[model samples]
Target chain A: MSRVLSIVTGANRGFGSSICQEFVKFSPNKEQHLDFILFARSADSLKNTKESIKTLSKVANVIEEYGVEMSDIPQVEKTFKDCLDKIEWNKYSKICLVNNHGTLYNLDKIDTFTDFQHIQKNNDINITSFVTISSLFLRKVKALPNFKDLEVTMVNITSLAAIKPFESWGLYCSSKAFREMFSNVIAEENKSSPNFKVLNYSPGPLDTDMQKEVRETCSSEETRQFYLELKKNNNLVAPGDSARALAKLVFTYEFTTGQHIDYYDIKEK
Target chain B: MSRVLSIVTGANRGFGSSICQEFVKFSPNKEQHLDFILFARSADSLKNTKESIKTLSKVANVIEEYGVEMSDIPQVEKTFKDCLDKIEWNKYSKICLVNNHGTLYNLDKIDTFTDFQHIQKNNDINITSFVTISSLFLRKVKALPNFKDLEVTMVNITSLAAIKPFESWGLYCSSKAFREMFSNVIAEENKSSPNFKVLNYSPGPLDTDMQKEVRETCSSEETRQFYLELKKNNNLVAPGDSARALAKLVFTYEFTTGQHIDYYDIKEK
Candidate 1:
């Protein structure tokens, strides 16, 4: 029987966890074994995700859970290297890497950003590590013994802020833009590989802890009010709903490689 | 008599030096005193720029030249803070900050990038320092007692790669995108300030050392050839020409506060 491997970062909770569960719940092939390699700040945090995935699909198994500090470049490199090295490459016909771990450095206007340490840390976590991990993943996977035959997909969890600037989301917006463009270059570089796919998926204004933080702490009163209105109107999309759409995109492979697919755009379809 | 203070980074050579020279060459009010603060890796390297500025405009003076390592976050913050503190804030009725320092980290496919240190350095130089300096500039200037009466302009030296993704230019494209988005947020954040102006200027392809590096070292054969053709045909823009257009925009201030005005866009006009 064929097998699939899904490596997900930030899989401990929120949208990341939802993505893992949805992928298994909606799997088209019950006969195929689905293995997961989950990464978060703590391996222990991935317990709920592992339990939920097992409950949803008997074919699914949580193969590995890594405790990783994404901001520490050296550690990130070491952890990913060990994980990829241990993977039984020949056992899986499909592989997907979801680069989803991120943070809101602060909800403040650009002029007011004074803490240089905070800024550097934000870049280290969001841009440096993301690039480092993505580079490692592509290099390792492409060198596999049966590389051409395996279907590969890379997803970047992006945002509307990636393309549009927001008043108080200076750091967040720039980092997202960086990731989206990086994903674009990946798509362009791998265009010749028929079995390779790249996607930038914007999960929308999710009703997650991040959203709550945005509503409470945004420096711009107007922006904060906007999020508050979204919350009050019950308009923020559920993590599961957005995750299901993302899962559908991953399985169907309907998107043009490097295309950015937002939850609303897919929902309208 | 009104005075203008211009702070320009990467002013030691290339397009940066051209901007300093052009600003003096095209000053509308020749009688008005012009003061410049130039930054580059070595203050000694700024001799040519300082000399040329003096030759172009009798009233123009190189007030200060700072040697800065753009990749060092703490140093970047300290240098800017010290520079801003020494400025006679009340003396200048017009201030313009030209953020022009940048680097091409590499010319290879993203998958082949293995040096995590190189990636971190690129982000430090391109994104982190840019934000740090810009924030410092804005905060310092805005706090002036006469800020409302002063004309404040912020120019981000952006590029075509900022909006378009190129194969084998992953790091460069992503950093530019980050800067452009950050500039957009600056525009949005300060829209209510009538005297404030921000511009993201894409100077087009320039005949410079950077372009030479591109032609010789680009990993993509097609990209290298395209740049080579531009050089052979003398199609590459002269730094002086593009700098003149940028100066025109600064002086005219006809553009919307947050507009991205490319050289080609203005050349047609």
Candidate 2:
């Protein structure tokens, strides 16, 4: 039996942590062992997620955690490459990378947030790093022995902002849009490679830290009220539930790449 | 008897310079005086553009050139604000800003360009500064006496990349997309006030230094060949011709805001 490797970002909290939980508790079968490499900002925070994964896991698994600062691209690339080097690539029949780390740094109107420093910082952390990591992962997997035999999946967590223009969320919206378009381009680039899959997944409005930021910081009354209502009406999807739905969609054998899918899309199917 | 103030970026050469020429020589009537504030990297280069504008302009026009580093937001904002402050707001019947400055810095594959520093720099100069300049222009115009009577227009020069995905041009494509979406949001925000109009204009493939860069740097053979063919077949539109078409669309009385329009879209009208 072949092993499975799952790498995830923002694994210290919210949807990211829940994603780690979902994957760990997913299957109890003894045939395929699992390995988890989680990326987060704090070593202590990752320890908590590592502990939770161990408790829920039934099959024997290896859980590794790293403190990842998205702004430091050099360090990020090195850490990811090192992780790949340490692991035995031939053992895993399935390899997946979930790019879940993102930031809505400021709720100011795009023009009001005029400082290039702030804009550059946000772009680096949210969009550019995501691109770098995705590139590195793809390069690593393609170098593996019998790479075509193993399934390789790349998941980019997208947002409604990717398609919809929110009044005050310009930076967030456009960056997510970039990720979606980049994913589309990547999918097109890899059309000839059947084993490789790219998915831009919009895990709709989860009760995450990002939502809290939106609720608190949004400049427009309409946007503020919309998020407030989601919370007031208990309409926001829980992180765990979203994670389960996302994992279900990801693990589905018939799931196609090059698609921007939402939680409801998977749920309806 | 009202004058016209035209502020343009990347005006040292190429499409930007042509846009300046089109506006200066637009009307044969001597009643409307023109004031041109052109931005570029070097003072000497801007002087050359100014000299050309002086030679081409038939009307009695005042041309001022400013060397601006687009990467520096504070300097860009200050220079723009100073220029606006020096002008008599009521003097010009039309106040227009043309955001034509853009850089396609390092057109390497997104993943292969692993350095976040380079990516961040490109994003800052291309997109963030454009937003800053637009915001400042809008603010300055709104503060003008009898602002509603003066025709205020903000034009963002976009590319085919704004709507289409091209390989190895991730940074350029996404930045243009951001500008397009930003233009949309700005138009929506100003809908209640009709005097303020924002346009995202795709000028098409002009024979500019940018196309030259594309021809030289495109990593994908298909993209490289396409641009090469454009140059070889003399299919690329001249900057002056593109500028005339763009100015025609811009100056058209029936043009609507909130539309992502191109040369063909205007020409067919």
Candidate 3:
């Protein structure tokens, strides 16, 4: 039987957890065994996700849970390396890495960003750790035996802010752009590897805590009103709905490598 | 008599120094008294640029030189704040900030990037320090008396890498994208201020130490050959020529705010 190992970051709540649950619903084949490794700020935080996965799939097992502080660069490196080392590479024919963890620094004009420490912390979490983990993951997996036969998929959870600048979202927009471009570079570097794929997925403005933060703290009154109206009009996307689209893209693998695919861009059959 | 205060980073050598020399050549009018503040790793490093500016325009003066380590976030904040506090805001009717300081991190494939410390350092220099200095400059200048009457221009020394991904150029490309998006947000935030403008300028391939680094350290043989061919065929741009075009863009002020103008995009008459 071919086995699959999936690793997800920020897999404790909202969209991250939803991706875990939704991915299982799409993969019910008795011939394939599924294993999961979840990462969040604390293993305890992933309890609900672990329970939900158990309810969703009897064939899927939550094999590991890592409590990680993404801003701690050294710790992040060690943790990711340890996870890869512990994995039995020959046990799985397919592997997927979801780089989904991120932080919204603040909702303020760029000129008003006065806290240097806060800015550094944000970059460490959003940019530095993302690069470190992704680089490490790719290096370790490619070194495995039968690498050419094993399927590898890398997904970057991106946003509309990655392409368009939003007022009072200076840090968030720039970090998303950085991730999307980095993913593009990865796709370019691995173009000859037919078994390798990269996807930049924008989950849309989901009804989550992040949206609530945006509505409350956005410096521009107009932007704040826009978010509030989206919520009021029921225009915000559900986490499960967006996650299903992302899973469909991952499983179908129809995208041109390095393309930015939005939740709204997906066509349901 | 109106005065212009222009602060430039990476002003010790290469394209940074060339900008200082070329900007002086463009502002030969005696009616516009020009004062400069140059930043590099050491104040002594800026001696050549200072002398070159003096030879170009008798009306231009090197007002200050700051020795800065861009990777040190706390020190960057302090140095930029000190520079702003020492400036006589009432003495200048126009202000310009050129965020030109940057480093070309090693050209290696994304998966082969193993040095976490190096990655953090790259982010600190390219993204964190740029944000710190630009924020301080904008906040300090906008708080001055008669601020609306003062013309302000902010220039980001960007590259084609800002929009395109190249194999083995992952970090460099992502950082440039981050800066470009951040510049776009600044434009969005300040759209109401008719006197405020931002420019993201791509200088093209220049005959500088950075291109030499690319020719030496690029991991991909194909990419290395591309740069090598540019140098061999005498196709590399001269720093003075590109800097002159940038000076024209800044002085003529014909571009839309936050527009990315490349060296080749300019029409010379």
Model 1 residue B218 distance off true place after TM-score fit, in angstroms? 1.4
Residue pairs in steric clash, candidate 1? none
Better of 1 and 3 by DockQ: 3
Candidate 2's C-alpha runs over 4 A off are A27-31, A60-62, A114-116, B27-30, B58-63
Question: Where is model 1 chain A poorest over a 10-residue stretch in terms of lDDT?
Answer: A260-269
lDDT agreement with native, every candidate: 0.93, 0.78, 0.92
**Tens digit per residue, CA lDDT, model 2, A1-269:** 88888999998898998988887665445456778888898767887778787787656454677887887777777888888778888888888899999898677764465565666667778877887788778777877778889888899999888877777777788788778877776776677788889988888898888889889889888889999999999999888877887777666645677788888676543
The DockQ values of the predictions, listed in order, are 0.87, 0.46, 0.90
Ranking by DockQ: 3, 1, 2
Error of 2 at B168 (Å): 2.4
Q: Across residues A1-269, which tens digit of lDDT does each residue of candidate 3 receive?
A: 87988999999998999999988987747547789999999999999999999898788889999999999999999999999999888988888999999999999998898898899989999999999999999999888878998888999999999999999999999999999999999999999998899999999899998899899899889999999999999999999999998877777767888999998888363
In model 1, which runs have C-alpha deviations exceeding 4 angstroms? none
Give the better candidate number (2 or 3) by DockQ: 3
Pick out the ten consecutive residues of candidate 3 chain A with the lowest summed lDDT. Answer: A25-34
